[model samples]
Target: MDRRLPVSPATPLIDRFGRQITYLRLSVTDRCDLRCVYCMKARPEFLPKADLLTLEELTLVCDAFISRGVTKIRLTGGEPLVRKDVITVIETLGTRIGPAGLDELCLTTNATQLPKYADRIAAAGIRRVNISLDTLEPDVYRRLTRGGDVNVALTGIAAAKRAGLKVKINAVAMAGVNETHLPGLIAWAHGEGHDVSLIEVMPVGEIGADRSAQFLSLENVRAALARQWSLTDLPDNTGGPARYARIAETGGRLGFISPLTGNFCDTCNRVRVTCTGELYTCLGKSGRIDLRQPLREGGRDALDDALDAAMASKPLGHDFDVSPGAAASVDRDMARTGG
Candidate 1:
């Protein structure tokens, strides 16, 4: 039985700055198999399972957003596949894709579980995925992810390709870490028919490391890549912050997401909801509304009110800084806030 609420026309969610909210990055869980150095601590405390919204609750919240004009929903997490019965959430949302409903439904994953769920994910209406892969070298990958096997992720990527799902490799460019190897990684991803996007490491949480040392600006990256390859800017956007370019040498598209060096908040059209149903209007700011209580206590009407409140409180921009010896912009880790 389809338990999702019917999508109906409603006034679109527009922030004070007039940016219409069309994209929702909803985190299904805070639990993950690998603890990346930049995302979380090696021995981070996991969120209590009881604190997370149930699959039914998640679906209802999504449907409410759909009714209010959210067209693109990206399921994120501390590895969303680690959540039990996540496919149920995916399948439910899959039915909502059409002219009258969602324009696209996608997820960001580490690709460790793609080998197990790729076919099922494709069948559930997900046409593409963004895989977080920072390094291709085995030892460096293991050290970065704290015991994760690169081979497993590679196998998962292959499985995703075989299942007919478009894959995009998302690498966090860190100074002195994977900076030297990124060219090879990009070429390999392009050779494998996958688009690649390099992201500047964000200071989201206290990972016990100096973020300034890790922060690799995309401006420097592009200049270096330009010297090696003929790069041409493209007017391509995937409803996110990435700026794309065509790598003429590989005949592939490359993207740069520079939240620090480049402020993308002017065109920001998305908000995030954590697994616990906390709605964050801006990722770099700590302001959030508790949608779980309203949804659980007062149902759809209350949920709608909370949504409106979120839009009204949406900040025009984020305040992310990665200066030397600087603290994290927000107290919450990327996993808790959604990756």
Candidate 2:
């Protein structure tokens, strides 16, 4: 069974709405060192190692997407660095970056294990990394991540900088938790020459907490910051849903990903693949297409067919709601959904 996709290019993955899918967020593992309150439960039931797609299979999938015109691949996970030999995955994908292949290869990590792998990550051709740092207060960080260390994450950020990897901070804005600290966090991140994006809590998985209570709209966040800092809108698109603004005070960029307050579905150009090879066309939707079975059972043709099916079924937008007492729009945790 030859599982490799042909080197020739295929038709671009364009949805019914006419948006070309050029980005893929591939999760290598669902396991993480910290259980962020908004992402997962304190004690999550991780999938068995045998259930995940093998490294070879992952590469095959990447090749398939690249053949179909997906140019940017972002490695994501509960924590991508926690995946064993993840650098190998990065290195494999890095080879695809060129004029005729992928334009960029990057990663999104919680940064707990980054200090150990930053140099290797940079060497593997990852020029930029998006690090998750919700709060700078040690106590608040511990409370949000369920016993995780903030200093460790800080050290990882420093290491990533030392390795010459551009850093971007992703902070999930919570109403009472990190609301007040966000200003200072943004200032500090900007001062350190790192971009920061503030995200509103999405109704993705049930983590035994009231999401409505935790939900802090980016509208409010931006308004609050406007009072303190001069924010001028910027026309920068990072191939994601985030809307960018330049802070006049910090002379830094700030992004806002408001899945609830602002719907970014009309221009969505990406898809997420779980570690188990499940393709999620929309993060706020539960619909999925299984690519692992096709790759294993029918090889390249079957996998390409599955990818086409996924693009066809890609929804116009997600229906994420954080209204009081509303259940999660998607029951899968952000960890399992590729962050």
Candidate 3:
């Protein structure tokens, strides 16, 4: 181990392979209202409350990350709003870290619990909202989610848009599952002034395990859409989160998350901290640096050193491209990992 750290807090913190760590994805809670089959097992159990990082500890960690060049922060959850005093947690973090410190603050939600709290969340300084809508058809939605209410999620999405939040819909494009609804979802969200993204179903964990038949690549879906719509490449950004373009003249835009197709792993700058306080350097790979133990034993400085170590330890890129067999064999559950 080199054990060399970033020399200055002002310099963008570069990892061992020189990847700059700029974004931090924080999972507020592991508890969720719906049991999405992709994210969890049927009737999956929850992480004990005691194991989760308290609001105060989360805030302290965010402060330290921001100081070391983490300019963006996104709060995630098994269902973030389901956490008690959720809005307050948002307010506390937002007030403590603003654009001066943290350039962007956002959240990823399933939208089931969003209708009740969208306005409150927007008012609390959330910059954008990414709602996960796998399918627009109610029957298929229920089938995929196992028991979630489609109407409830739609209502929440409407509330989020009405609240003036930048809204984006995330759909997992699974073959023979929700892929058929892609065109309709694109049309719907475009008409409503929202961006829709089609993500390839990741072969992670136990739910989609051994179910290779369900995987759908971006190329297959793109070829399907290219017949009707002429697509153009939108300008790329440093973060490379969304690869977006307009849908001809319909005023609706589409995005493709081609993680499997092109492997954007080289530029991956994110570090995910699960609700249980484990810091994950890459979403697709495993093994985390434990921050909770350091936080409990040594206060804020220890937390800072942990952040520094994690940023330095991030890999140049994931091994998915070179070792396709290993990518399929990796077995961490997405829900527990806060995907």
Best by lDDT: 1
lDDT of 1 by residue, 240-274 (tens): 99999999999999999999898899999999999
In the range 1-339, model 3's lDDT, one tens digit per residue, is 111222334446678877788888889887888887667778777888988888777776777677678888888888888998767768876774555477778898998877788888888888688899988899999988888889999999999988889888899888888888888888888888988888876665666334456678888998899888888878856254668877885677788887778677777778889888899887767767999988779766677778777876776655543133434434667777776
Task: Note each model's CA RMSD in angstroms.
Answer: 1.0, 1.5, 4.4
- Which candidate has the highest TM-score of all? 1
Which residue pairs come into collision in candidate 3? Answer: none
The candidate with the higher lDDT, 2 or 3, is: 2
Q: In model 3, what lDDT does residue 253 have?
A: 73
Off by over 4 Å in 1: 6-9
TM-score of each: 0.98, 0.98, 0.92
Q: What local lDDT score does residue 211 receive in model 3, on the 0 to 100 scale?
A: 43
Q: Each candidate: what lDDT? A: 0.94, 0.91, 0.78
lDDT for predicted candidate 3 compared with the true structure:
0.78
Candidate order, TM-score descending: 1, 2, 3
| Predicted candidate 2 versus true structure: per-residue lDDT over 1-339, tens digit per residue | 124566654789998889999999999999999989999998899999999998888889999998999999999998988878777778888888898789889999988888899999899789999999999999999999999999999999999999999999999999989999999999999999999999999999888889999999899899989999999999998888899999999999999999888988899999999999999999999999999999889877888889889888998998888889999998899999998
Name the TM-score of candidate 2. 0.98
